[model samples]
Target: MPRAPRTRRSKYRALSSLALLALAAGAVTACSDNDSASDHSASSSAPSSASPGTGKVAKAKLHMVDNGGHRLAFYVTRGSASTIVLDSGGGEYSSQWKDIAPKLHTATGATVITYDRAGLGKSDVVPGPWKVESAVSDLKAGLGQLGVTKDVTLVSHSQAGEIANCLAKDNPEMLSGAVLVDANLPQFFTDEEIPRLVAATQPEVDAAKKDPEKPENRQLISTAEGFAAAHKAFHEVTWPNSVPATVLVSEKTPFAGSPEDAQRWRDAAASFAQEAPNRTLVTAKGTSHEVPTERPDVVLKAIEDMFAAQH
Candidate 1:
């Protein structure tokens, strides 16, 4: 394949101005979560203020499903060919897939849909100390409730890697393929292996449980909550899903990692290929963590590549 075009620095430069934008947007329009190795501090150029479920994103068609007695909120962006159900990261719900899913739908002629976990977005936050299985159950029950049939594709980002993996492992019949965008690989970094990463997220979690609706407390809660959600999400994820998988990972290692970490990430992607043989691991250069926002076109190509390869 040829080299992917570099995104202009100015595109990412606006990250600095996002916090004020986030606070003003009235809390959220997307969803996010974190892992042990995930970043805690806002980069000088990261968009700290992009709310996951508010403002322009509020118009997203909300859907509900029953999971273990709790009603979960999920959203779908309708398209007309095949359907793609995307899982957003921790601290994030269905709203994070807002722009990118639509793009994928248009480019590939697929219907892209995303939704929130139990308490993450428009859904009610229930009791029982959420676990990774809850997420898996949510996906299963949600799809069943929505009347989504077999032969679907899974598109996920960050912590959502677990959701996609769980589906592929238990119910291989539902999938045509899987797309992992900056995904998690427990074989490389497990729950116990990322304690420091977990510790950094407690503050953010506490802040969200304390006040998810406050604008002044945004900085205090965002990172920690995101990390806590992701840490919980990591336990259920695994490799060897039966269908062909596409792993889209970032080339840059900003911190909490080394050059070898990228190598490890690729090696994990390589492992996915080893299992499926048809799995394609594409590296989106000049990015880490937030590939969909940092460089969507690169992510877009990987989707096209995998879908094409399957045909």
Candidate 2:
């Protein structure tokens, strides 16, 4: 309940560097599908093939489950006792866990679940702007259908952290712990700061808008919608104090922003960790924002720590 420490591993200097960093980092193209709000009724039946680039389609470990009438694809690493659910960032499929899932399983012997969100990979494309509520619902429904109703640890990256937060908030008893890898936190960006932050992502937005036909572009659009939704959703929610959590902030790979912006990033991460009853911040070095890909060991260790805390 005491004021959380100002935990940081970097330094900040000026707003000029911040502005330039804002420009260079915030250059993602500005684009959104206005029709994403429309809900399409896709068949909830699971598909036999894995989504493209969702790693090897090992049938024995593959699952297609109905998450509120929409079929979602999941790749599982079967283990006894605990189940670690890997939630990828925006624009990524379950394959993003390719480098870490096996290692996690080997290290902890916990069942690892990684899957594509509604419209990614081999999953059916129903609608756009996958809201945080919908995302969390899908995850919970998938787990329920798989008969995994207990002893779960959520491991989330980037925007997917919103879903993890929602799950942890509403279903503390359902989760053993949570690990956020270079994730977006609740209310981390202020209104005045939002525009500046959006500016930095302009390049990514532009690229997606330029090529509607490209799969990458489509995926980017889907990811963008999820980001937009998170921006609004995180403000309305609160994290529960009961669930144990760890937030891994990447020090080597700073966000594309000024030193000041970087400081904000670190401070936000620290704030997220400080809010919960049992939470810690780990400054991950020698890695970029893609810490799961670059430093799977950090993620694995975090998962291990979370499980240990529960027992």
Candidate 3:
């Protein structure tokens, strides 16, 4: 088949980039190494009730796990019984949950875990497109190494929702429940929607290409490379009814400026929740896509309720 006109192709690409840019709005701003030291201090200083009668904060332990050839960093705060795994959004790493992780640990008395995904934070970058299977494998391997095999409460944000869905479907036995914070729901990736998102994100992808060496750009490139195909397949993903989930949709969604897109986002969340009896949808009032940051109390309460329900 003959290729389309260059102008038309470029137009489509620019649209695709805009969609991805909306999805990854704040991600670029957090692409610095400055969070590393501060994250450590925050985790260490945050009060934890895990230690009975001692009144001392729980120390967070760092573990380097090998995935194929590269290494992924996992941070753990020791607690009892259940384990809560916090996954970050697109173009972000483990430090995205630095504040919430420690607080969750203290509130629930459950072992809280956070980790840097491949090519982000302290994890070794693997050249190539971002793949959800690889992401799921990394998380599973790290959890296995840590002996965290059961009773897991997965707290995922934005892009990590894809990882959480796959984990819940593929390894239902490993997770008891989940809390999705302003996340990307598979319901949003319909045949028509996928093309729109890809087209919208094209401009951002093009800009990232100019500065390929930057950490955020690298992530954007990898993610954009597979966005259309990945989401097309993602549209077919079904969340298992066995694993209960709480879906939190921001009042002003990731595409707040675009009314049509914003309504679609909200509708998708409602659709996902309606699909299963075990799923519950909650709106994060007065917040944007950065729900965890804007309303940590809501995120905390949701996770706490989910954890408590499991027991």
Best by lDDT: 3
lDDT of 2 by residue, 65-113 (tens): 7654567777776666678899986656787777677666666666778
What are the per-residue Cα lDDT tens digits for candidate 3 across 1-311?
A: 12235643343234323332222222322111111111111223322334434567787777788767677888888888789999987766676777788778777788998888988777889887776767787888788777888999999988888788777877889899999988877888878787777766767778878988877667777777756666766767788999999999999887766788889899999998998888999999999776777788899999999999998
Please give the ranking of all candidate structures by lDDT, highest first, separated by commas: 3, 2, 1
Off by over 4 Å in 3: 1-53
Residue 10 displacement (Å), model 2: 26
How do the predictions measure up, each by TM-score? 0.66, 0.76, 0.85
Lowest summed lDDT across 10 adjacent residues in model 1 is found at 15-24
lDDT of 1 by residue, 1-311 (tens): 12223321221111111110111112121212211111111111111122223322212355666665667765655444466787865445465656666556556655566777756666666543334445676777766665666757788776667566656766778788888887765444444434544453344445445765542233324333343335444333455546888888777632224454456556666666566566777778778667777787887777767666654
As for lDDT, the candidate ahead, 1 or 2, is 2
Q: Name the regions of candidate 1 deviating beyond 4 angstroms.
A: 1-60, 190-192, 195-238, 253-263
How high a TM-score does candidate 3 get? 0.85
- For all candidates in order, the CA lDDT equals 0.54, 0.63, 0.74
Count of clashes, each model: 21, 19, 18
